[model samples]
Target chain A: MSEVNNKKLRTKDLIYAGAFGALYIVLMLILVMSSGMVPILYILAPITVGVFCGTVYELCVLKVRKFGPALIMGLLFALVACNGAWYCFVTATACALLAELIIFLGKYKSKFMYLLSFVVFNINMSCPYMIMTFNRDGFMTRARDYYGEEYANGLSKLMTPWIWYALVGFAIIGGILGALIASKLIKKHFTKAGIV
Target chain B: MDFDICVDDSGAILKLDPRTKLVMFLTSSVASLTCYSMENLLIYGIVLCVITILCGKKWLGVKSLLIFLFLIFFRYEIVTSGKGSAAIGGLLTSLITIFLFFFPVFMSLMLITQTTRINQFLAAFDAMHMPNIVVIPIAVMFRFIPTVAQEWDGIRKAMAFRGISLEPWAIIRSPLKTIEYILIPLLFSSISIMEELAAAALARGLDSGNNRTSYETVKFRAVDYLVTFMFIGLAAFFIIGRKGL
Candidate 1:
């Protein structure tokens, strides 16, 4: 336990994090950009990203077998996706910290714990939409003026508290499914190829 | 157009420090997000366009400005007029709004990535006394984004040859196959690339745990100070003027 706890991330681990982090981000950007144009898909972008990005992320965590990589990857995501939103940076860091804590609890060996951490990590996807909730009246008024009253009405309808709750629930389920797929892929491909 | 990360600073009209560019990116992004009026957005956008052009990315600056103008035109002349079908008009309006909302940050990102090299970033971070833990990964990530783009291009070509069209309709029809076809090869190739990169970096004494020097001398110049103050001022104005909308 001490040995596991004492291991620091070397240069190699950091590089691996960067490399895999890039891949994860690229995958996420592809998912989000493709889905973002449509309102419903935009709302569901987190689930799609969660489903696809787990493989790359799980691979990074397993390869690095340390705490810093998750936080680093989260920081990278926050930076890339911030788009001027400070809340994104805060949410991403907090979620990544939570993920790291979960992994630490498992001493970086429990596969289940890794998957559980990923579920929490997916919560950061809600960050981009947070402004809508935080400044609801301002957002709605702007939306109404810019996009017309109908569009604003639709958006406001979607912004109900229960909808956000449901979206979060769906995202968690997507994370679980994604983690399972990642574990299977790691076993089927990475382990056989000795990459893991 | 060539998308190389390293620009030839010799031809650059304005050579600002990486630190200055970073501050500009952060401040401009904050300003753009908090901004409430179209006039403020235009001012912020024009300032960024000028900075981008000065940084030697003339085509990108011009292209982004054109896109912004076009979006603004569409939003006002077409979308607001409500000439098209309501559903399609609404979708287009929302899409254009999102694009306008994020345009400044994307432009700043392009400015940073297109102008500054990885070594410059490392030197800047080092000067700031950032831990190696944070510095190495970011540097590597910066270097790797272009490589990933190149790899994705190659993969797309291969997929096309194999009759795996990445068109929206095709992707929507069979998402699983699309993922299996594209992701597997990409992951495999990326792993190999990561290994090579790690090996090369390690061979260069990346883990020596000593103070490292760089070939490029990184220091804040007069231009950097000017740019920093300008962006800080813009950000403050945006925040203070938030209620003006």
Candidate 2:
């Protein structure tokens, strides 16, 4: 019932992915239903989805399956999330992909992947928000256009300095924390948890 | 008969088909957005509240939406004080508009979903040029959230036994570290899960067209026609009303 390394995917493995995709869509509807209150919920959602589902698929498909399939699934999910205006979807997907690559690249046994994945994640965090606000008639343009000179005059009003940097820094660190937790847990219980 | 509010489980609108409820929702939103007159908006507001009561979803969800609109109006006031009375009026109008605008769109969404099964909803989209590639994957993704949440809870408890407090901020300060150490396994699990799902679907004999079964069946009842006509009638009144024509 076990193999050192297998490559051929069982039919059930594909169905598992499909099921997860449907699950993702339904969760998205739930998100829309509760958009305002649960902004941070979805930010952490992709990591869990990627880890559990991708790990299970890899297990069923190949005892020693690499991260390639999971990476592709992530890339697809990101593209769809982007089109769907689920702003953080792409960033989340990128984070997952980067982590997988790092782990596999580091030979799945290095603490270095942990650090590398974290570093890569910081640059990735700014991407989606930038893409979000940089479009025509978008928030950045709107803010600049409507606020005009007052925006540049250092706002004769109160503001949070370093808030933006804090957001990026914290979120990326949060993502790394998530990855670290997964790696540790999976290494310990990958077998008994049936995670392959 | 027209839709009526029922008070059983959670005090929601009952006896309305998904499609009909959806239409009403959209209509409400559009009407709210289209009308700027405070008087008109107030009238529409009453009508919406009544409908919400009728539909039985008199939850905080609807109430919160209105509150959100009010917040916007309040913010607008702070911003529009110098823009004149008309600006104030416009800002309020915009708030009202946004609140109501969701009505028609979400009503249809709620209607279809409420009256029909999930797969049926998927089928409707599928019939309407929704690519399987898109629909199928999205469905899977949607279902993954709860499962992951459950797993995370388990992991948190297990970690707690080893004296690890799963507080998000307490873990580390850098976002990069979190990504590397925590989330990669998530994406990895997602891809791995798919393999099992694909196999399961094959076992179940789900091909392109194998009579996708569903639980809910809906048709245009007499009352449905009546409701549709009522919408048209109201729309007509708006179009032909004073200042409209």
Q: Give the top-scoring candidate (DockQ).
A: 1
Q: Per model, state how many residue pairs clash.
A: 0, 102
Enumerate the candidates' DockQ scores in order. Answer: 0.56, 0.16
Clash pairs detected, candidate 1: none
Cα lDDT of model 2 by residue, A131-155, tens digit:
3233323333323322332331222
Candidate 2 segments exceeding 4 Å error: A1-15, A18-81, A84-127, A132-137, A143-181, B1-61, B77-116, B125-133, B143-209, B215-245
TM, every model: 0.92, 0.44
lDDT of 2 by residue, B95-178 (tens): 333334344444433333333333543454555555454455444443344445545455546567867554657544654444
> Best by lDDT, which number?
1
| Candidate 1 stretches greater than 4 Å from native | A1-6, A82-88, A145-148, B80-82
Q: After superposition, how far is residue A141 of candidate 1 from its true place, in Å?
A: 3.1
Q: Model 1, A105-170: lDDT tens per residue?
A: 998889899988888878777666676766666667766755566677877778775565667776
